[model samples]
Every structure is written in C-alpha cells, then in structure tokens.
Target: MKLKCLVIDDDPMICDLVKHFCSKLEEIEYCLSANTGNDGLQVLSQQKFDVLLLDYHLPDMTGQSILEIRSQNIPVIMITSEKDFAALAFDYDEIVDFLVKPLHFDRFKKAINRVHHGDSNSKSILQDDNDICYIKDGNKYVKVNYNDIHFLRSEENYVAFVLHDKTILSLIPLKNVEALLPSHFKRVHRSFIVNLNKVEKTTLEEITIGSRQIPISQKYKKEFFEILNNKLL
Candidate 1:
C-alpha cells in the first residue's frame, strides 16, 4: 500500500529532511508538511494520512496535545530531541515509534518501516531467542524470560505483557508479540494470549492464570481445549 505522510514541525529543515527521506522510499506516495499544530490539525481534518511524523514541541502546542485532540486513528512517529518524552509517547495508542532527533536516514527508515509493519505479513522486528525476548519499553529494552510471561493483552496498538510482578507495555500489536513468543504461548481469545505453561486451571469459558480468568472465545476454544486436553494425564 502507498503511504501518505504528514510531517508536522516548526523547523522547515526538519520537514524538508523528512520529505527527502520519504522520497527515497518507493512505498511513500507523498510527504506533506505543516509548520504549526493548528495548521496540522486543519490539514488532518481535510485529508487522511497513513502516518504522522510529529515534532514534540511545536510553536503553538506540544505533540501530546495533538494526540489528545486528534480524532483519527493515524499512527504517529514522534520526533524529538528529548529522551524523557519517550516514556510519555508510548502512553498514547497512536504513537507507533519514537525517534530522537539528529535523525539519521537509517533510523528514519526504521520508523517508517514500523508504520508499514502494522501489516500481518511484515517480519517481526523484536529480538528473541530460545529463552527470552527483548521488549521495547520507553527508552529502554527490558529482557523478559519467556517463562515469566503469564499472558499478553491487546490494547489497540499496544500490547501489555503481564509478568509475575508487573506489566510492560510495548508499542506493538499482539500478533507481532505472538510471533516473538515461545511455543507454550497460545491465543485463547481475540484480545488475550496465554502461556500454556502458566495456566493453573480452565473452565468451559475461561482460562485461569494466577488471579485472572481470561475468556476462551469460541473461535479459539476447540484448539485451546485440544492442546489442554493432550496434557492431561
């Protein structure tokens, strides 16, 4: 699919740089620009863009404000010099990638690739091995043992990885997360993926983890029960 991009930044050079980068990629149809948040909002209302390359600090308002006010579900790639905002950017479901400025062509390409990676066919970009997976949380990559993951819940564009003690939110779809997970993990419902090894009990409608009972949807019930039944001694 051809991508229509919007670059919203006060800096003319940054806008030009993004346009130039977009030009290099054949998938991008055109890269449009807006200098202020108000102008950007106006442009957004008139036309639908595939992805947004937004500057955190605009002349009129911050990128966070735009995210709150915008009605569309357009995926955003935040561009900023501040590292601290990394934590905040992931809080919004619209944000897919965060790029710290002094943006290199390679990193820019990576962010654009993330926008494209929303498709089911795109290869998983997460780092994983036999024992563990590196999950991107804010500015840091958290190493999580595969056995430690109890379940994963889909939160629109984000997935919440439920560990024993805490939950880590990563800017990725559950399907993508599923691809990185080990064999023990299974999709028990539309929004939930459970680690079969961590399951303590199961009923006709739900699978029990520690304290949570996740639903077993009709679509996945037969396959899930077949796997569970096979383990019965």
Candidate 2:
C-alpha cells in the first residue's frame, strides 16, 4: 500500500532531500508540500494524506500549533534540527516519531514503515488463529504465518526464517526483523531468534524445538534465561 505524504518545511533543500528520500521508497508517494505551518494547514484542509513529514519550527507557526488545531488521526514524523523538542513531540498523539535533522536513510525507512502499519504495536496481525507477517520475495511481497516458522537465523546481510516445510529469506537485517516479530518470538542469540511457543525443551546453551536445536549465545543467554524462567513458572 502506498501512503500519501505531505512535507512541511521552510528550507527548500530539506524539501528536496525529503522528496529524494521518498522517491526511493515503494511505500510512500510524495503528495504535497508547504513552507509554513499555516500553508500546511491550508493544504491539509483541501486534501488528505496518510502521513505527514512535518518540520518542528515554521516561520508563521510551529508544527505543534497545526497539530493542536487539526485532527489527531494522521500519523506524523516530526523532523527538527533541535534535539530539545523530542520531549515535546510525543505530547501530540498524532506524532509517531521524532527525527533529528540529517536523517539516516535506514531510520527514515523505519519511521515510514511504522506509519505504514498504522503505528500498531500489537503482538501480531492475527487472523483465523494464525499470526502473519510480510516478506519481500523479489519484487513481490509474500505473507508468511508465524506458526509455520521454526527459527530465524542471521546470514550476513539477510535473515532466513526456517519453517517446518519451507524456509523464507528476507533481505532485511536481523535487528529489523526482530522488531517485526511478535512477543512470543525471542532472540536467544545475536544470530538466532526462536518461537518461544514452539519450544519443546530448553537448556542453558540451547533451545530444542521439534527435533531441531537452536543455540543460545552468551550475549543474550542471561536475559533469555530470565524470560524463559518466568514463562516456565
């Protein structure tokens, strides 16, 4: 699904940079722009957008003023040169994330992704007793059920999800994939993530699921055992 995005920034260079960053993402389409908060509000009133890339400081008015006067429905990622506004950004329910200037591409993508999911922090998008997630397969995206997944193993730039019948690979990093997974999934090692509910047994050094064993590295062993112990009791 493509998101309609509006940019509100006074700097022409920042506007161009935003457009350049968004042009590369399949999820967001650059829809509109405004140089000031009042202009932004006028554009907002005339059209609709799924997300807003708002600059904190505007010539006529601040981004906060616009949010206060408008509907809190749209997800906003506030971009600011000043780090002091981070605490203030969260006061508005519409603001999903606060990004400082000189935005990293990966960080920008993650912010856009959060907006794509409607800022959902649910365990997973469950349907018909199945938990599902999307994986990019070439140009097409595929839906994979969490129940079918046995474990996730990191492979250089990619992470592979081993299933009972088939394995699914994604180009996303292990850390990013971990954030997408539900609470029932645990990262017991830097290179391994396992479904806690699928575990048949657990040892200090490894976790056994079905007939396969997944190694638990020392990096995460302490925290892993703490969570597992609580679940056991």
Which one is best on lDDT?
1
Q: Which pairs in model 2 have colliding backbones?
A: none
Q: Over the stretch 96-155, how does candidate 2's per-residue lDDT look in tens digits?
A: 765678776766776788888864431122111126454554444445778788899899
User: What TM-score does candidate 2 get on C-alpha atoms?
Assistant: 0.56
Question: What local distance difference test score does each model get?
Answer: 0.82, 0.75
Residue 46 accuracy (lDDT) in model 2: 84
Each prediction's RMSD to truth:
9.5, 14.1
**Could you give candidate 1's per-residue lDDT for residues 97-193 as a string of tens digits?**
7777777786677678778867532222232335645577766667678889899999998889999999998787888767656678999898999
Q: Residue 60 of model 2: what lDDT?
A: 92
Could you estimate the TM-score for every candidate? 0.56, 0.56
